[model samples]
Target: MHGLPQAEPTNATIRPGAAARRSPGWRISRRVRIGLASLIGTFALWWLLTDITGVIGPHRFPAPAEFWAAFVQIAIDGYAGGTLITQAWYSTRLVIMGFLVAIATGVPLGLLMGVSHRAEALLNPAFLLVRPIPPLAWIPLAIVWLGLGDAAKILVIWFAAFVPSVINTWTGVRGVDRTLIAAARVHGAGELRLLWEVIIPGSLPMMFTGLRLSLQASWTTLVAAELVGAFFGLGRVLDAAYRDINPPMIAVAMLAVGVLGALTTRLVAVAERRLIPWRS
Candidate 1:
């Protein structure tokens, strides 16, 4: 007994279970509930103002019920002999292609500019001059160069998405802590190794921020691009509805665009959360 070791109590080990895992879902549901409530309240106010007060005539600002009915009809019957699904698919494809092009060019260019003063000096002025020009302004040039097809739409979206990504990536790379670079060098890390390991990891958060902004810009520009001189997109559907003075159809198109944009933004947010898990 004098030489024996004493046994220790384990206490009640309280490890998290499935219930704890479910808490995130509950939190998400609570937030969704709040959002839905707010949307419902806002729509109620809109309906009351339009229907009861008659501040804006029903002919001009059609009743919310009418819009809802129209939206349902369009969803069921499709638009301009083409399904809403078709138009949405076309727009989504163009956006994705354009976004990919932007990232391919912008990220490398940004990294070059960030790492090399000469590259920045050579390219920055041109980018600054070009960036201020709106995507709509490029529509004429895009049409001239690529014509009234998928190519033109994709080009317009690329222009819209590229600038923010390049600027943000450049900023991120430039902002990497100098001490990390020195330490990497001290450890005999080669330029490529340092860049891949130290610089990229450090700069990833800002790059993701840029990516999110680029996606938003791409979504906004897609409608404008389709409206200018093209067919088979949500924007084109909206344009046709406007021309026909079909307010309900117009509302449906608008709602579709808003939902798609919100969904894209949320997807990007999810990616950001997963990729940058260290961030609060």
Candidate 2:
């Protein structure tokens, strides 16, 4: 009996390559390869349609070379008296301002509503009414109230972001485990302790989800807000390009919006990883 070899765990035999599959680096590398392939394939199709076939006219859609030329021109020579960098920064700044304000205001109010039935009853109906309204709808009122300034732009962006933040946060808090709440209560945890230890930690993932959504909303609304009266922003760049019938410049501006949005989303992802490392 002492000389007999010990049996290998049954689980080990069933999970071949499981460790490799579970490796974080392996997963990340796989995702990177897939994403790169997708981008390359898209660009190849675009190039084929525009440059090779010429089925799509330059006036309708700029070729890759034209797009590159337009990008370089805006990056160096400037457009409407502002370089692309400055214009993109203007839009990004508005997004940041509005996003931060939404987070600051929405999270606390959401927490209140989540914990208090009375508060929820009082606020939920109003939020429901406002949630269906489009951010673009706020543009006319914003111009009237705040004029053609950054304030008007920020207001529009703020409204776009605020609803998602509050809704997601509220939903997150409400989604916290009732069993955990009961256990905490049984253990004589006070309401504040229950909130801090049991609720907030549990709800953080959803809260961060809300933040990401809010940031996206901010970027999307920034473009529309700037379209109305901004002197310097990607949206204004787009407007000018349209008025001049310059497809290349329009393509450049649209690309800038997409790139900037992606960059900001990356920033939010980094923050999410830092704040919620367990989930990451």
Per-residue C-alpha lDDT of model 1 across residues 43-114, encoded as one tens digit per residue: 988888888788877667678888877776766887865777888878888888888899888888888899
The lDDT values for all models are 0.83, 0.88
Tell me the tens digit of each residue's lDDT in model 2 across 1-280: 2463333456346764664464456555656878999999999999999999998999899999999998999999999769999998888888899899889999998899999999999998998899899988999999999988899888898899998889888999999999999999999999899999989888889998999999889988888877777778999999898889999999999988999889999998888888777774
lDDT of 2 at 39: 97
What does the lDDT come to for candidate 2?
A: 0.88
TM-score of each: 0.86, 0.87
**Cα shift from native, residue 58, model 2 (Å):** 0.5
**Residue 105, candidate 1: C-alpha displacement in angstroms:** 1.2
The pairs that clash in candidate 1 are: none
Q: Candidate 1 versus the native: TM-score?
A: 0.86
